[model samples]
Target: MVGRADDAVWRPYEDGGSLGWMGTQGGTIARDEDFGGLARLTYELDDSRSFHALSCSVTGWLLYHRFFDNAAAASAAFEEMKPALEALLTQLPEGGPSVPGNARLGGPILAAFTVRYG
Candidate 1:
């Protein structure tokens, strides 16, 4: 569901609560039409990497990813934050805003990851 920087819909996460992870400055919500109504809630970090929780209306599962400068870093960060991410995942609501099946929510995170690693 990721979009190019020029085309992606980006909005800051306004909810006023700590994300329960370190180095997180804030987060953004991204939406796109090509990802089966996937919404991505992505958190910005002090480091070059970022974290995300990808959700859709059809499933309660939250896909987690750590977008880092490199695969090595991503892997390491994923490991370091696995427990916290899992806990966060449990707390996220199921079935976000209703959108078309082709819509995607995590456009910015997906776009950034693709550009940096793909």
Candidate 2:
């Protein structure tokens, strides 16, 4: 899962990685709850919920980037779910990244998303 998440971020394809193919796997949850994970903001700002924005950004990236792979399918998925996530992002307030106690993990991890599409 960590590798998959990393691939989704860095997209180090030369290293045998991918941003992964995001599609409706199966079941309602996959489309609903499971995919919800993709939209959960991976960041936080002093308990302010950066993860919500991160989720929207990542899901949007997946929807837009992978559209060519299956245009109709991708569009359908995006239509079924992009609005609410977008609304969540709009509601989020910006703040400085919350630092944790440990030096290594002190900085924000999922506070923001870096997306790439080819």
Best by TM-score: 1
Score each candidate by Cα lDDT.
0.35, 0.29
Error of 2 at 105 (Å): 13
lDDT of 2 by residue, 24-82 (tens): 32111122222233443221111222111122243322222222233354345445445
Q: Candidate 2: lDDT of 37?
A: 36
Clashes of 1: 6
TM-score of each: 0.24, 0.23
How many steric clashes between backbone atoms does each model show?
Answer: 6, 8
